[model samples]
Target: GNEYPEDLAALPPQIIIGAQYVQAAGVALGFKKKGAKNVAYTYTGDGGTSQGDFYEGINFAGAYQAPAIFVVQNNGYAISVPRAVQTAAPTLAQKGLAAGIPGIQVDGMDALAVYLVMSEARKYSVEGNGPVLIETLTYRFGPHTLSGDDPHRYRTADEEAEWEKKDPLVRLRTYLDEKGLWSEEQEEAYIEEVNEQINEAMKKTEQAPKQKVSEYLQNVFVETPPTLEEQIAKFAAKEEA
Candidate 1:
C-alpha cells in the first residue's frame, strides 16, 4: 500500500535548512506511534550533517524505533569544504550506527541504484522496525548555490572531466540509444515542449497576487487575538511605507 499520493501534489515544496530533518523525524515518530502504515523520509546535504539538529533528530527516531529514512547526498564537497574536512570518518553512513540505525551507501550517479536502495529502505522502515540512514556518494557538478561560487577555486579541470564521464543522464541516454529505446529527435522535442510549459507556468505565477504575512498568521488561530490583529495592522502599515 502507498502512503498519501505517489505524485505528492498535497505536500508542497518547503525550504528549511538544518532543522528540516528534525521536523521530519518528529512527523515520522508521530505516524508510527499512531500505528499509521507508511514510510517517512527526509533528505539533507553533506554539510547539513554537521549540524547538531541532524544528530538530535536521528537519535530521537532511533530511540523510539520510529520509521524514518534519512538520506544524505554526500557530494564530494559541501560548499567550499571537502568531505574530508567535514569529518574524519570514512563514510557518513556509519554515523547512524551510534543511534542504532542501519546505514547503507549507494552510487548516487546511477539513478537505478538510487531507486533500488530507496525501495528497500522504505520496506525496512514501514515494517515498524526503525529508521534507516542512506549515504549517497555523488558529485555536485555546478556551484553550491546561486551565490556565484567559482568551483574552479577548489577543484581542478581534470577532476571535473573525470566526474563528467559518470554523468547519469548521458549514461542513461547512451544505454537507451543502444537498445533502440530512445532517439535524439525524441529528446529534442521533449526538451522544447518542457521549456514552453515552464515558460507558461512562470508567466501564470507572475500574474498571481502577492501574499501577505497576515494571511498566514490568521490561518493559525480560529479566532484572531487582539495582539495578532494589531501586529497584522502594523505589518500592513510597514508594507505601505
Candidate 2:
C-alpha cells in the first residue's frame, strides 16, 4: 500500500479478486459505529463484479446503510475475456440495484466528469445514506499484464486506436492547456521533479539495513510452535555464520 502508519485508510494491493469489497464494507461499518463521518472507498474491475464476495459485500453494506463507495472500472475486458462474455447485466452499475443502493454510470474517459460524479457519490454516502455503486465506462489500452498474453489476438488495431483518441490524460491535458492552465514546459518540469524524487527514494532504500530470514521467522507467531522454532533456530545459526 506504501501507506504511512498514521494513515487510517489505504487500499493495499490484494491478490484475491473482489475480497477488498467485503473489507471496505466492514471498514465503513466500523466508521459508522465510531460515529465518524469517514467513508470507505474501494475499486474493482468489471471482472470482479462477478465474484460472489462482491454481491455479498454490497448486500451487507446496503442492509446496514454503511457509508462506502464501490467504484467499478468497466474497461470492456477482464484479462483476455471480453465484457459481453463475462456477464449479461445491462450495466454493471445496475448490479447494485438488487442490494437496494443507488447506482450511477459516468463517462470514465472524461476526467472532469468522473471527478464530479465521485464527489456527489461521496457526499451521498457520508450523509447517513447507504453505499453507492459507480460504474466508470473505460477501456484498457493493453493486455492486463505483460505476462505472455497478446492484445492483438483479442483486440483489433482499429479498436485500440479509437480508445487512444479518448485517453483521459491526453484529453484532460488538452483541456487544461486550452484554458491556459498547463503547458509543455510545465509538464517537462513536473516529470523531471518526479524522477528526482524517485531517485532520492531509491538512494534511501539502498542505504537501509538488509532484511533477514531469521527476523521474518521470529515475527511469524506470538509463541512460535516447536516445528517453526526449530526452523527459526536453524536460520538464525546460518545468519550468524
Candidate 3:
C-alpha cells in the first residue's frame, strides 16, 4: 500500500497532500456521504501538512461540515526538513483554525492520550459537528526512509538520545510492564513469533512467479485507446525482437 505519485497536479484536490492525506480525506468524505452516524478519520505527517493541497482539503471539509478528523503526526522533521522550516505557525493544529475548524495538540508518544482525543473528536463529528484537527507530537526512530540521509546531520547526538528515552514503544512497554501484562519473556516471545512470520512471508514472496514482460501493459487502461494500443504494440514488437 506504500506508493508514491509521479505527478502532484493530476491527483484529486483532496489527495493533493499526497497519498496518505488523500486516503484519509477520502475515508472521511465517504463516511459523510454514506450518511454514517460516525466520523471518518485519517492521519498524515507534519511534512505532508505543509503541502498546499492539505490546507485546501481541510478547508473544504470544514466549510461543508464534513464529519472528518484530520490528524497530523508532527515528528519534528519532515524527512530532513525541520518543522520550523516547514511552516511559520507555532503548531500544525492551529492551521486548522484558519479554516474554521477546531484543532488540538496532543502528546503522540502517549497512546492512551491520543486514543482519548481521537475518540472525543469522533463523537463530536458523529453529532454533526464539523471537522477537527489533532496534531500529535512524536519522533521517528529510524531514518526518513530505508535509504536516505542520516538524521545525525540535522540533530545532535544528545537530542536523539533524549528522544530515545521518550520513545513511544518504550513508554508503552513500560506501562504494560507496570500493569503486569508484559515482561522480558513476553517481549522475547513476541519478537520471535513476529520474526518467524516475517521469514515465512518472505519465503513465499520469493517463490512467487516473476511478472511477465507483457504484464506492464495490462493495467494502463480499461478499454485501450488507439494511442495506448499503438504503444502496446510497439512494446510487444520490441519484446519479440
lDDT of 2 at 207: 100
Given candidate 1, what's the lDDT at residue 195? 100
Per-residue lDDT of 57 in model 1? 83
Give lDDT tens digits, candidate 3, residues 1-241. Answer: 2122222112232333434454455555656666656565677899988787678778878877887888899999988899999899999999988989999999998988998999899888878788899999999887887786798888888888888888888889989999999999989999999999999999998997655445455544558788878877887887779
Candidate ordering by lDDT (highest first): 2, 1, 3
Off by over 4 Å in 3: 1-19, 188-241
Model 1 C-alpha lDDT versus the unseen true structure: 0.84
lDDT of every model, 2 decimals: 0.84, 0.87, 0.78
In candidate 2, clashing pairs total 0
TM-scores of the candidates in the order shown = 0.77, 0.78, 0.71
lDDT of 2 by residue, 1-241 (tens): 1222222343334578898899789878777787777778989999999899899889999999999999999998888888899899889999999999999999999999999999898899888898999999999888899998898998999999999999999999989999999999999999999999999999998996776777666544558999998998998899899
Q: Candidate 2: where are CA atoms >4 Å away?
A: 1-13, 196-241
Q: How close is candidate 2 to the true structure, as a TM-score?
A: 0.78
Decide which is better by TM-score, 1 or 3. Answer: 1
Candidate with best lDDT:
2
Candidate 1 residue lDDT tens string, 78-101: 888999999988999999999999
